[model samples]
Target: MNAEIIAVGTELLLGQIANTNAQYLSSELAQLGINVFYHTAVGDNSSRLKDVIKGAQQRSNLIIFTGGLGPTKDDLTKETVASVLSVELEHDQKALNQIEQYFQRTNRHMTENNKKQALVLKGATVFPNDNGMAPGIAYKNKDCLYLLFPGPPSELKLMFDKYGRSFLLEQLETKQFMESRVLRFFGIGESQLETEIEDLIDSQKNPTIAPLAGEGEVTLRLTAKDNSLDRVTEMLNKVEEEIQRRVGTFFYGYGTTSLHSELFKKLQEKKLTISSAESLTGGSFANELTSFNGASLVYQGSIVCYQNEVKEKLLNVSPQVIKEHGAVSFECAKQMAEQVRQTLNSDIGVSFTGVAGPAEQEGKPVGTVFIGISIKNSKTEVYTLKLSGSRNGIRNRAVKYANFYLLKLLS
Candidate 1:
């Protein structure tokens, strides 16, 4: 089934808010094997919204809308959609009662304008919003399915995941289901990865290969459509194997897993604990690891040695070593990693030392970085990089390379 998403808000066009709803809906519809051909955004003007809806109905079998379901006068999505569909609007008693209960629970007086939120188009299936006052609705009229949802991300996510998806899935009757696997890679450019598998991509038919690059990483999304889950998995494995044959060295983990997550998982799997001595990244590596739940099992601690004196005093790096090789050198990085691991008594140690720029430091160019990882009885390894971008970008990429190297070492 083909689907079209319409975002209704003046704020979106004015850059006051981003239209993230279209991205979410597109991904969701793709999982259901529905092709999302168009994404339309219109301001609060009802005539333009009507035109968009009328245009969508002529081309799409499903039209989904987000925003303009609030209490203000500018919230005219429901009214305009009702007018276009030749349907009447009536206040839903259940929705009105829920709105009243919400106001009562908060000890706030409900305004008469709040009643507008309870209005639903005639003969539409009401979707109760557990997260907010504005209820969603799904209806079918004239061979097109129309769905309305709130603009707030949290509320829209909850309503769609809880109710909207089930309605669409039931209405959709496609035998083929699309399954995708995202393989993430670091230390390899997107062009390099694609070039390695150019033959496979060129000859692709049943399973498609797509490469994406961002923030010093590359990802290959392998999508296959099949009725059976096992068949799709097998097809994906075959494609993955072909790609891995050429660019396997850079491939790290799969599907929604970041370098930090994969590093943490590898640490836990190998029963390793790590300590970090951070300089230019300012403890961002440790912060990223701790953001994942249950990271304390593998994360020992971190020391943010931003100052030269702190590096000498805390991580036990000699002042002469800093003077000789500079702080962003491989020698300094190795010492920092070894000292931090020995001090914290962790199985592994990681260090980030870099010159993230606006300006160069210690005669080293901006974006010059050295990441060091030390393991038990294993020689400390240092990876040097000359990255590009602003200070924050360089720092972020440095930390990511640190985790990527740590994962590789653990493997």
Candidate 2:
């Protein structure tokens, strides 16, 4: 079904609030193999809403409206929809009873205007709102299906999952299941990844590949639809295998997983503990690692040695090495890693030292980073990076690189 989502709120237009309801509904609709063509947001004005409704009726068969379902005068979604469809709004007895009971349970007097929350279009299927006072309505006028939901995310989500989803499913003549897999990658640019799989994307039919670039990472979402679940899974797997074969070296993990999370899981599984020595990153690596629960099991501690003296005294870097190579050198990073591992008695040690800058340091340019990893019973390893961005961006990317290298070591 071709769907359009109408979000009715002046606050959304004014940027006071986001229309998250459209995002949520679009995702849900995708799972059901329904394509959402447009998302239109209108202020709480009946005339503009009517114009939007008319435009939607010409293009989409499924029109879902969110917001403007409350007791306030600005809540005009149902009223405008009723006027457009030439149907009268009538009070649903069950909804009226529920609203009265809620006020009674709270021991508050129900104002006359509050009764408007019980209004529904004539000849509509009323979906009870378990979390709020406004009941959702689903009505078919001619060939179009109009579904009205509450603006609050909590109420809308619950009502849609409990009632609205099933209603849509029943209306479908043939049921088709859709599935998606998101492959997460780092250390690769989005354009480079796309180039590697450009053929697969260009000639795509059933399983479509979409690439999205996020903060220092990229993801490819592969979606497939079929009548049989097994067929859908097979189609998704086939596309994913080809994509993996092309750029599998950059692939780290699956959906919603980050470098730090993957490293945390690996450390826990291997029963290894780690410590960090931070310089330019300023303990950001340590903070990211310890944010996870039970992090103490895999994390010993961190030493933030921003100053040359602290590195010399705390991490025991030789003064001669600092004088010769400076603090942002590979020699300093290697020594810092080894010292932190030995001092904290951890299975592994990682160090981040660099010039993340508005200005260069020790003749090294900004974004010059050296990461060192010292694992027990293994030789210390250092990786040098020349990056670019804001200081905070460089720092954040450095922390992620630390996690990525540690994850590689543990793997």
How many clashing residue pairs appear in each of the predictions shown? 0, 0
Worst 10 residues of 2 by lDDT: 402-411
Model 1 accuracy (lDDT, Cα): 0.90
Report every candidate's CA lDDT: 0.90, 0.94
Candidate 1 per-residue lDDT, tens place, 108-192, comes to 9999999999999988999998999989999899789999999999999999999998888888676567788999999998887
In order of appearance, the predictions have TM-scores of 0.84, 0.97
Best by TM-score: 2
Of candidate 1, the 10-residue stretch with the lowest lDDT total is 169-178
Model 1: CA > 4 A from native: 15-20, 70-72, 88-120, 123-137, 150-163, 292-296, 303-314, 318-328, 358-363
